[model samples]
Target: MKNNTPSTAHLKGTRTETAHDGNAKVWLNGKQLNLQASLKYCSKSPTGFNWGYGGSGPAQLAHEVCRQLYGLETANLVFQDFKWRFLVTIEGDTFDLTLELEEFNVGHVMPLIETAEDTDLCETQNGPTGHGETCYFDADQGL
Candidate 1:
């Protein structure tokens, strides 16, 4: 049978290169990804986004990427795993990470992230939902 999933080939076009001498940069589909959105969602990482380690900044970065590429709903579902898999794995002082956004999307939707116990995700002023102390999910909600 032929494949029917959306093509991410368009997403493969990336342009994240920046002056490495300064702060680290992340680009998606050939554009710079700013920290403003990330900060608005999660007030952590006042200094800005970072990766190669587990921290608030990485969490924000992961959240932002998932939020932008997929949507806030999916971001809440897959961000923690996204953080561990991509952001935390990026290393070095001057690293430019360009990833296949849809690859994350294809593997991480629906049943995989359908349960709250599976995600350990919570709601906070600076967290996913930007509400309450903890957030829960309705598995039937679907992606």
Candidate 2:
């Protein structure tokens, strides 16, 4: 399938770093961010739709880091399927922020997929309802 994700180069500047002390520290325009916090923010599903996965976790974390670093309203991520390469952009300059999973202890916070009924409700003409709700086969139940 074709990837439709947009670029983040229009934000501000790029922040790059490698994993250090079990966390990745990112610097952008002299501001600093601890990626451990980013992991926590991204690991949780905002919509509670799908439990965060390794694939989406990094993307979400990167997007958030970009926002904090550059004060950008939006950020985007593009992933290379093989070996899990992620190309993220914020606003100004595009650069790579390398994060090694092992170095950052990513496995500890990584989300798992499981089968379960979705207790979340949806909006309807009358109100919120679960009449047509379906079970989530790959959801994170722990979170």
Candidate 3:
């Protein structure tokens, strides 16, 4: 029996920013995001944001912003499960920051396959045996 299963795959992409007037701006999927402005917004929120003293803070903020902007569950899962490296610049100062996801398990579920087809539906008479019948196969039995 041949197994056809989808495995967890890495969804990776890059976000690059150019420094201008002490701020860095990046265009992601045609949407422009300002690094400094996002950080400021997060910081000013009532909950408050800390880019941690250890320097992992900015990267976390960036990931969260990306997740919010691009609402894809799979991409968000990858972001939360993988370490991401970001290149940020501030007033000519460049920082290479690494962000790691908290340990967690992603449940795997077998996908349902639809093998039964309506063989009664045929387009042309040039089918098997010139009978205009569609053929369906049972791969497991090699029929």
Candidate 4:
């Protein structure tokens, strides 16, 4: 049998690199985000990978992206099939969520994120989500 799926880079570099200056340029909702201003720490477990953030800006972007993609009314993080999924609710009483996975290509593992929008809650405003939280997981953690 021959493989025909497109190559994807997810969680590239050694585990140490994840702890290094890991940055990402995430594109969502028609905008490009440059995150990792305060590169905290990234850990990989059986479930998937989790990264911590510093500055408020990075936190906000991650929060919105996660909520919009996960259809979460509050804030939550889940994992499935070696992929990390974030859930959050937007300001307009709408739900959203984000899913992230590592794409491997030879010697590269890059992250690929996808978002899902349920409804247009553009006018909803109740403040940001997922902040001031430190997450820890096991290296062999699986979902």
- The candidate scoring highest on lDDT is 1
Q: Write the residue-wise lDDT of candidate 4 on 1-143 in tens digits.
A: 01222332122111233323333234544344233321222112212212332333334444433333332222223222122222122222122233332232121211111221221222122223333343433334621
Question: For every model shown, what is its TM-score relative to the native structure?
Answer: 0.61, 0.27, 0.26, 0.23
Question: lDDT tens digits, residues 52-135, model 1?
Answer: 689776776677776666566566657788889776776564454455546655577544444434544334553355431126
Which of the two, 3 or 4, has more TM-score? 3
Query: What is candidate 3's lDDT per residue for 1-143, written digit by digit as tens?
Result: 11232232222223224222223333433455444454332222222222222234344344444344323222222322222332233222333333222122222111111212311211222345653222334455443
Clash numbers, per candidate: 3, 5, 1, 29
Runs in model 4 deviating more than 4 A are 1-53, 74-143
lDDT score, residue 64, model 3? 44
Say what the RMSD of model 4 is.
16.1
In terms of lDDT, model 1 sits at 0.56
Off by over 4 Å in 1: 1-22, 97-107, 110-134, 137-143
Considering summed lDDT, which 10 consecutive residues are worst modelled in model 1? 7-16
lDDT of each: 0.56, 0.29, 0.31, 0.29
Where does candidate 2 stray beyond 4 Å? 1-23, 44-61, 69-143
